[model samples]
Target: MMWRRRHIFDPFYELKRMEEWMNDLMGEMQTAGGLLLPESTGKEVAPISRVPSIDLIDKGDTLVLRADVPGVDKSDISVNMKDDMIEISAERKGEEEVKEEGYIRRERHYAKYYRAVPLPASVDKDAITAKFENGVLEVTMPKVAAEEVKKIEVK
Candidate 1:
């Protein structure tokens, strides 16, 4: 006679899921303000010049890569294509001196940053255009036509 097996549903999975939820909730409360900040090494995070939190959208025949590069100078921003990625770099410096005293708390500091995003659609690198103003950098890379795409044959 062959032995029969029984399938048992594990109940601990629910407990694990609840554990994750509680951990996430606690982490958010810990970072609600500077009160939750970790000890710094006395070294500031070198701003990426212009690391744009971006939205890559497809608009017909073009891929619109919009990055949120606030407080970045238009002159300091640059867009370059590397292999299959688009790179944007910018640098911003804070005002040197504060005029009056009693400025107890000031946290709006600035630094340089660089951001790179991959283009989802095939883009016409030569036809791309970029605009920067109000501290926003927008780079438009036109999609390359299907007929324009080339594939390599592997040996």
Candidate 2:
């Protein structure tokens, strides 16, 4: 006679599995809605985009721009200023565990973000200074002095 071991189902294990499934679903929805939520080190939840929100301020002598770029490496960010336009770009890489787990419902947060702002006045591109700290980027650009207008009399 062949004897087969009978499998026993534990209610607690099933409930825990269900909870995990529900959490994964909610995470997907959050990511789809373009939500940027805080990340927990214990377990990476839904990977939200790392696109930095920005604020541009027009000061008397300099144009100050602040961007909220969290969870992004400093080396992945770039800023460019040309004439009266400023461009900002950044990228975030997805977690390796999420990629390895092909069946798990996770937000593939590998994302690239780009933004351009037009200055209200001309600025000195060479004199621009930018600083990044605590996931925030601040850029200061000096404004060019206005040229004096000389009226010419036409005969």
Candidate 3:
């Protein structure tokens, strides 16, 4: 008879497998617009909350942040700055109606976005400026001047 190799059980093996499965499922769901749920009107719908992509750049005396918020109206976007943090939020609402030879289909979709960024340095909140153009929001914040350090000689 051939000798059989013994197998060892890992306590976290199942947990790791479950975590990987969950990650894959979440990825697929995000790409596929999430799981579809039946509506009261016998329609299948999926709710989506988009996380906007952002880029933060340090421009010496200023910090510039740019975020992509396509399909969102400028009026629906909000930017707030407090202390050393900045928050951005936006909402997009859309409705579509299609009429065929015998049936009409109507669909409505809503998506919201929110992001908060912490500044690496002190900023002049009162002088902050923001602009939205071409589905992109740009925020410029001026950095506060650093106080000069006086060197004292030790006796």
Candidate 4:
């Protein structure tokens, strides 16, 4: 006679295995630049949006913000200002073609950037100015005058 050992099912063990698998999958997705899926044409597509690096500085009377937006034309950038927030968005499109002896290769690249920043103080939107030069965008916003608080005497 042959003896057989029965296996026991543990729900917790299954859950732990699922968690580990999920973590690994997420790590790979990030390394591959977000989730990629194949289209009907057999081409891989991924999300093309990114956040541009920026520097915000407060100079007492004004707030200066500098954002890096390389490979983007000035006409492709847009800046919107509200009482307490500023929004920046830009897009870049490029194409490259190469022809070697018997093969022709072409590639297209696209990039989109968006960022919204909240101001710590009220700004004078009418006096705000922006400049885009050498792939860098600089925005200067004047701070609104603060009202003086009057102290009351108590007996």
Find the candidate with the highest TM-score and give its number. 4
For residues 47-140, write the lDDT of model 1, one tens digit per residue: 2222346778898988888776676678867789987899877767665545567665444556665666777767888899999877667788
121-154, model 3: which lDDT tens digit per residue? 8899889999999999999999999789999999
Decide which is better by lDDT, 1 or 4: 4
CA shift at 75, candidate 3, in angstroms? 0.2
lDDT of 2 by residue, 7-64 (tens): 8667887899999999998777786864334352222333433345788898899899
lDDT to native, each model: 0.68, 0.75, 0.83, 0.85
- Highest lDDT among the candidates is held by which one? 4
Which pairs clash inside model 1?
A: 47-112, 47-113, 48-112, 48-113, 48-114, 49-90, 49-112, 49-113, 50-90, 50-113
Candidate 4, 18-123: lDDT as tens digits: 9999999977886888644434221333477667778999999999999988889999999999669999989999999999999999999998877778988899
Residue pairs with backbone atoms closer than 3 Å in model 3 (clashes): none
> When superposed on Cα atoms, how far off is each prediction in RMSD?
10.5, 17.0, 8.5, 8.3
Candidate 3: count the clashes: 0
- Where model 2 places Cα greater than 4 Å from the true spot, the runs are 1-51, 98-108
C-alpha RMSD of candidate 3: 8.5
What's the CA error at residue 40 for candidate 1, in Å?
19
Look at candidate 2 and tell me the lDDT of residue 36. Answer: 38
lDDT of 3 at 59: 96
Please report how far candidate 2 places residue 32 from its true position, in Å: 21
